[model samples]
Target chain A: MTGDAQTPALPLHLRAAILLRLLAIQGVWNYETMLGNGIAFAMEPALRRLPGGRQGEAYRTAMARHSGYFNAHPYLAAVAVGALIRAELDGVPAAQIDRFRTAAPGPLGSVGDRLIWAGWLPLCSSLALLAYGLGAGPLAVVLLFLLTYNFVHLGLRIWGLHAGWTQGLRVAQALANPLLRQGPAHVARATALVAGVALPVAAHALIGPGRVLLGSVLAAVAAGATLVTLLHGRFEGWRLATLALATFVLYTMVR
Target chain B: MGGDILFYVPLAVLGAVLGLDVVSFPQAMISRPIVASTLAGGLIGQPVRGLTMGVLLEFFALESLPFGASRYPEWGSAAVVGGSLFAAIPDGSAGAMSVAAFAALVTASIGSSSMVFLRRWNAIWARGQQRRIARGSGSAVVALQLAGLSADLIRGGVLTLVALVVFSPLNRAIVGTFSMSPVISRAVVVAVASAVGLAAIWKVVRTTAGARWWLAAGVGAGFIIAGTL
Candidate 1:
């Protein structure tokens, strides 16, 4: 706790380096170490300032320690990088640091998966699909997705770094922020509504007035099939659809 | 299929970058099907057609979470392959979307395996450097990271090249000799895609408390808009 005051702000260049390296933090992911290697790689720039410099014992120990098993959502992993760097610099006890690393990934992974992957991503995607349904140009739709999605993506990375560094071992506090806690549900609701709106609009646009009745019938059948598969819970509708496509293609080629 | 083979090189390159975006870097959903496919289509001066392929593929892609260490489809490179193949066909080809979707799904499965291979390869390489990494050698960590990235890039490129080379002609062959009526073939494809898409939306809607009503309302609104249109 006293380490918060003791931990000096990471220099601008070091912070920048950490940010850049965080981009590739999942590059070396493996079952053994998960994201351990990437965490060390991202944290190295900061660990350089440890008492002995890059070749110093402190730097080496911190690097090796961080290079052990770890995992987190790739985007939110920046928080771990920042917090770990601070903990190392603050000279938090070695045993405590390991515990922190172990405890951290759960919240980071769950929150990030819920907020970004499950909520924000689907929301943006359906919105883009909605735009396409409403006859938005291709470029416009793609741009809308990239621009809107990345706005929060970049902000999360930057905010995560700042929060992690400043809060050090207490960085879990950052995850508790209302935006992180409640964002997924709110986004999910919006996504459902948007997706519902988008599907029919897109269907109408694609099928045109002449085939409206046919399109509706097909949609109804497809929906029924999907619901049956969903009830089964083990199988995915897309996989079934893919199998059907392959079967159709093969049947046509052979016949 | 008749376009210069050289065209595939750049498309493969684009695939590598977008594929890298999948989990390696800047996961800016530019790797999403809509973006990846559109880019591939734009490369061939058929952005709209690419967009069409992208939307269909996006339905399938929604099932992917890209969550921790899960073996999910690599939509980025796959979408590029699908978009490019679909765009390459002359307009009004009944089987174009179907063939492209098939190709993309196949490519995605390949991408998933390649990712698993890359992780295994990385594990071996990382194990080899375990000593140095433990010694806190910055260079060792950097080497592992860079090597892993480079390998992923190559994997994506090769996946794209193989998909394009193999599926391009196959797509043309199937579309050229298609037996199904255009309306029926397309209707089936779109209906299936819609089903998968609706299922994806429903997966989320059902899990979230009280979201179904909003979805129902949205559906009603959608019908109104469709009626007006």
Candidate 2:
């Protein structure tokens, strides 16, 4: 990649240090500005070495500026770090850099929260629990979970850095990319699929044969009804109603 | 049997590290109850017990979407308390697991409230250092960051210690006092957990078109697979 010659670029060693520091970017989180101070602290190394020939004045200015209000999901903060440094080196005015900061965190946060918190963690945790329940050893379940999760977790940090540096502020558009969107959706679907299949078998294993047969028919019917209703876009109250019905049935049968 | 310092010290340290990891360090899902509790149980020579407790706690923990400024229960240290208590209970009865789980859930709720105080303390410290930080002193920023990390570390460690000292005994007593039949209690746990997991699935898939077909196919295939087995 060609480095822009308008200003001195961040050195490779310095970039490594910044990425390492980014891992602890919430160390100084406050209720007022969240990771604001931590972001400033993480950027301190890169800021100190900005090559401005200004006797460390550049470092002071950079620190004070980044210490303002900032909040974003930690994993997605890499994108901001990469772009922020690139823009600083490109001599993008402080006002413009500030504008980029304000614009980036919100959208990137939603994408990260949805992809990671809502989508990835639940699915991976489910798979791990399912594996554990199926007699997979504890170590195997933990390792499977860690590997499946980090594939995306580490991948995003590494990828975000490159994307933020090269794409600059336009990196927000990367969230809209179809390839990126499809991965989470696919995983979500796979999770639901495996879970749907696995739960009945698990119930059967846990319960007895006669109970399995009766429960399977009832569960299948209830699931089918619920699925149809959800697919038609009316899913809000159905979960509670279904649970209440299931409980009533179970209590009656047990009595 | 009470946890000796050998067990207690490392578990507290583990709680510190994992608890710090919740907000300050890697934020790897290891801070999760399933992983954290399992690790805690293994440290005390009860890996299976810890793992079982973790799986149960993970169900209730799933409802939490820890994003933005949301004040969600802290699970890492709390899970250690739960797992350790369950493992320490004399009998592995359904009542035992339920009591341990309840203790952990209460610890998590307390942990959530404590986080607000921690945040306020961090803010107070940050406010004290604002001028120096703005004055471009690298040491000031470094000091503040280190202070915050140290505070969170202590917060997690102390929380783990207190919950263990207090709730471990409470959990043991509750298990002794309660008298639900094992079969019924276990069945109820399984049923409620399955319902929660199902609801979580619905939240994930209700929006995705054609999800029902894939789910139906899964159910039919599952039944057939079971028959062969």
Candidate 3:
């Protein structure tokens, strides 16, 4: 609320710099601070605008404070960076900024994880796989995934930056906006639908219909395994697949 | 051997870039198994083979969430190794897919461990510069970030090269000696992968209201399409 409506937006070049730095925001991720260092790295460019510049007391205090432990999904972290920059420029108190910083990561992390990681990513990936399963060329499938996924990826980054800046200390209003609130549920539903279409198509592709009986047996086995996994708790598919293949390899070796 | 060296060196470099994409930079998800493996396969003029390997690997990769600092398989470089190993085979030999998958899974484990090491190393570097960082030293922060990126690049390159060198010949040997029928061996791999992928998707689908109905409709539509095909 302290952010002045009269405060001009950051210079385009500085905003560009922060956006570029955000790309590598997880570069130095660690247990103690998670993405804290990366956040500082992304924020540094914008902090250069503080009263004394990088050499100024204001800049130093903001840099050191922002460098402390913080974690959020990489893409949405742009919102946090944008808001923090706005806060610094508006001269928000360090203690209040600290409170916002601590509170921001949990929502950002959860929302981004659910939306991007679980929903949109799988949906696009399934669509691409579905295309490939139906006999699309490899280049086509790859292009489909990259183009579709990045469309949202780039858009979200740009939107987060703009939203966080304009909202500034009142950025929670941005988080509460309908897009963030309702987007995840809708995307998750679409993901489910796409995944269902993909599964049988991919199976049919891999197991040609020429051997109807064999394909049926394999399909049944897959279904059973899927059912068992669903009934059980967490889906550790990678680990299970690894073990199954490793055992198969060993059997071949022994024989 | 010379021919392999020529192929693997470039593949290793590609792995480095894609692996870095997993976390360090522009996470366009090109690091996904489907793309990474296909690229590896393209390197040897066997893009379809790479695609096949990639599809199976992609199924397993779907289970990974890549949440904040969570330990998950580094699929990018590992997929490159798997796809290259599978493509290297002269023919669609029995057990070839299985061996390549096994190699990929193992390499993913290695990549996973290497990531942990890189994080620790990054921590050490950051901790050493903590005083400067707390003092608001921009130069020190930049140095740490650059150093972290470089180390991750190196980790990915070395991991890919080592996996290729060790698994390539081993893969050939296993494929050559394997006695399982081609149909059955391939069926097992395909079955496990699809099942895992389906189940992983179902987990998410079941949680959201109305999603299950959408899924059922999609499945029915898929079968109708398959039937016509």
Candidate 4:
């Protein structure tokens, strides 16, 4: 809120640099604290560029601060990075910045996990898979997956940077904006629409019609319905594995 | 059996690069099963086989979320094995492709286990750098981070090399010996994969607004179109 309205804010090149580093958030995965070093790597450039409060001290302090047990869904980690940078520039205390770090991963992590990992990614990949099953070329299929996923991927990073820079801590609210809230549900719906149409078509493509085709269709529905329960019920993955074993048994008997 | 060093060396390089991209480096997501498998297939002059493998592998890949400290298979290297094995088979039979896919799945499992070791090594490396990192060692922080990155790169390359060395022959042997009705086998794979895709849809829609209505309309429209034509 204190910056010059006319100063054009953080330079385009710097934002680009920060985002580039963020792309490797899991580069240094560790069993004890996954991405611990990767967080320092991503934050180093921003800490250097923050432009206030004793640059060297800020650099060391920020690096030490972010290196402590930091983890989040990679795509939304930008929001945390942006907010931390904005806080440092605004002259917020080191202790408070640590508070911001603590505050960050919960909202951003959950939203990110739900939206990116569960929602947008599956939708795009499924769409690409459907296209592939329908006999699309590999490059075209890869292009589809990249274009769709990265549009949101890049857009969210850009939004997080600008919003965090401008709004500081308050940008956490923006993380829950309808785009994250409703956008995922909509993508999921669209995926269903695509899957609904593609399922039958792909069946015909992979298996010629007959009693076998009818059985495949029925099994597809049954497996889909069963998995809906497994996914929704919060059952462990092993349960699904067991169900899959059962499915294999049934598949053999039915055939 | 080893007649094509020319065929495999470049594929190994491709595997290394994509495997690194899975969790390190640019992460342009060329590492995802769909793209990586396709690229591996294209490299061996079998884009269709690659595309076919990519689509199948993608079903399992899509099931994973890969969020926050969670461990999951590194599909990038595994898909390379899959694309290459399927393309290697001269006839491109469905039954043969299924066996190749099984081998690739096993490779993916091994590759991910290797990745866990790399993660543990990263932790040790980072802890050693913590003192300098806290005391304003900018170079130290950068060095430690890069070390982690380099380790991941090496880990990926090694995993790819091992999977290829171990599985390539097994894929050939299994495909050569396995004999079954192509229709039944293809039906099983296609049905299971389609069911996985559908389950993903069902998970999303059931949670979203008016999910039931949307599901009804979608199925109704799809069937109507199918029945009419």
| lDDT of every predicted structure (CA atoms) | 0.84, 0.70, 0.84, 0.69
RMSD of each: 1.9, 5.3, 1.9, 3.9
lDDT of 4 at B229: 36
DockQ-wise, the better of 3 and 4 is: 3
Model 4, residue A201: distance off in Å is: 3.0
Q: Score the docking of each candidate (DockQ).
A: 0.66, 0.34, 0.68, 0.45
Docking class of 2: acceptable
In candidate 4, position B67 carries an lDDT of: 64
Put down candidate 3 lDDT per residue, B1-229, tens digits, no spaces.
Answer: 2246666899899899989998897888989999999999998789998988888888888777687778999999999999988888865588888899889999998899999999988899999999999998888888888999999998889899988988888887889898887776777777778777777787766888899888888877777676666
Of the true interface contacts, each candidate retains a share of 0.64, 0.38, 0.68, 0.47
Model 2 chain B is weakest, by summed lDDT over 10 consecutive residues, at: B184-193
| Tens digit per residue, CA lDDT, model 1, B87-155 | 999877777778899999889989998999899999999999999987888899999999999999998
Show the colliding residue pairs in model 3: none
Q: After superposition, how far is residue A234 of candidate 3 from its true place, in Å?
A: 6.4
**Tens digit of per-residue lDDT, candidate 4, span A132-250:** 65667778889999998889888877787677777776677787688887777777677667656655554444454333465556666566657655665474232243355345534
Candidate 2 lDDT tens digits, A1-255: 212434345578877887777878888787897888877877777666566532477777777778878988788888888777677666677887888889888877877887787778877776776676566666787788878887888788877776777766667766677755776677667766776665555444333323434454446545654554454334322233334434543453355
Recovered share of real interface contacts in candidate 3: 0.68
* Docking level of model 1: medium
Which residue pairs does candidate 2 place in steric collision?
none
